[model samples]
Target: MSADNAAVNFSELVNKNKQTLARLKESPRLLLHRRDGEDLVLTTAAKAEQDQTVVSAASRMLSAMARREPGSMELLLDILPEAFPWVRFLPEPDVHAFAVELVDTMRAADSIGNNASVAQMLTAWQHTAEVHSDPVLLAALTQDHGTDYGPVRHP
Candidate 1:
């Protein structure tokens, strides 16, 4: 993110060995632009560790807040709409469910250092919202197929 010596070509690693390493050391990070596929980041191992530690601590704190104070979850529920516009398609109850599941999953993933689990959870929730967004699908799913004539029981 720093402006000075921020990026360098992948080929520079081999061509300018000494210079690239020096730049890596001086700058906080160096973006290694690649022609074939995804770009790579070059930074000190210490910096990477520090970033992970901070993220894990924040995740734990948020999880604890939701568990100890039920009302704290309302704040995260409110932001879901802004963070992901598609959530508005889902009903209010479903949004609350998503917020609870998200915090729990985030805490577990952080504990294990498994980022993929958190990403997968978000993808699943987004897919659920996508289904709700389709009116025809919702109607088909709710349509009554004549079966038992049981009386409705009130909770």
Candidate 2:
């Protein structure tokens, strides 16, 4: 295939993936939470809004990074304000440790052929959580998302 053809194909793939994501976002299971202590179960409208927010944020972050902008990190951080403040409280090295754990989880999920795309997208979430370690962020991640990284628990 020619280089131009390959580029077109790649763009088509990205668009198709976006459409699929939109459908998934419209599903009933997407969870929505606000910074103002309000949580809403995902209805169709709420899911669409949340989906757009997440997709737009992800796209902007990726574009900023691709442009090698110095402010890319800040832009990425702004999209996830809930977690950014926590990084200050966490020991610096532990941030990367959480990222490693999340990577392993993604690999595991991929090995099982279980929603590999979503699992891969979760790397961004892990990255954000890894950097920020405030009590509120940690608690929200652990309690709400089941991402406990504390002591081991026996079932």
Candidate 3:
């Protein structure tokens, strides 16, 4: 499900607290935009728990499917692009790899009720897709570099 949120300036929370909260009657979450630091989200406890429950259950189900199906990645390959449009930029094999790792990471993170790593993983993969989408950057990145470079070794 899509996140039901309304974005408002952080000052709104301090100045128009009542009006801001009233917005929550329509949207379950308030994304407070901050100028100085990271933005914060204001959400009801019920919404938070509901989101967690959904994530936890989906992660578990995907994990079980992964374990039960040897060709799970192939199955995921069909859906990954729909969920993450940028996955189309990756090679078929790498897309499968990304899907497998993403599902695994989601299962692990949601199992613990902490999604920091899940967010991190998604950002990293999206960046990877971005780089791959740029032919110049992809060629430059895959070019032979110095010894002991990341993902490359001196033969």
Residue 41 in model 2: lDDT: 39
Residue 40, candidate 3: Cα error in Å is 1.6
TM-score of 2: 0.25
Candidate 1: misplaced stretches above 4 Å?
A: 1-5, 127-155
TM-score of each candidate structure, all chains considered together: 0.70, 0.25, 0.80
Off by over 4 Å in 2: 1-42, 45-50, 53-56, 59-63, 70-83, 95-155
Clash count, predicted structure 1: 0
After the best TM-score superposition of candidate 1, give how far the Cα of residue 123 lies from its true spot, in angstroms.
3.5
Ranking by TM-score: 3, 1, 2
Cα-lDDT of candidate 1: 0.86
Between candidates 2 and 3, the TM-score winner: 3
lDDT (0 to 1) per candidate: 0.86, 0.48, 0.87
Which 10 residues in a row give candidate 2 its minimum summed lDDT? Answer: 1-10
Among these predictions, the greatest lDDT belongs to 3
- The sequence of per-residue lDDT tens digits that candidate 3 reaches over residues 22-101 is 99899988899999999999999999999899889998988888778778757777788898999989887778778778
Give the worst 10-residue stretch by lDDT in candidate 3.
Answer: 145-154
lDDT of 1 by residue, 50-137 (tens): 9889989888987988887767888788888998898999899999998888888989899789778888989998988888999998
Measured by TM-score, the strongest candidate is: 3
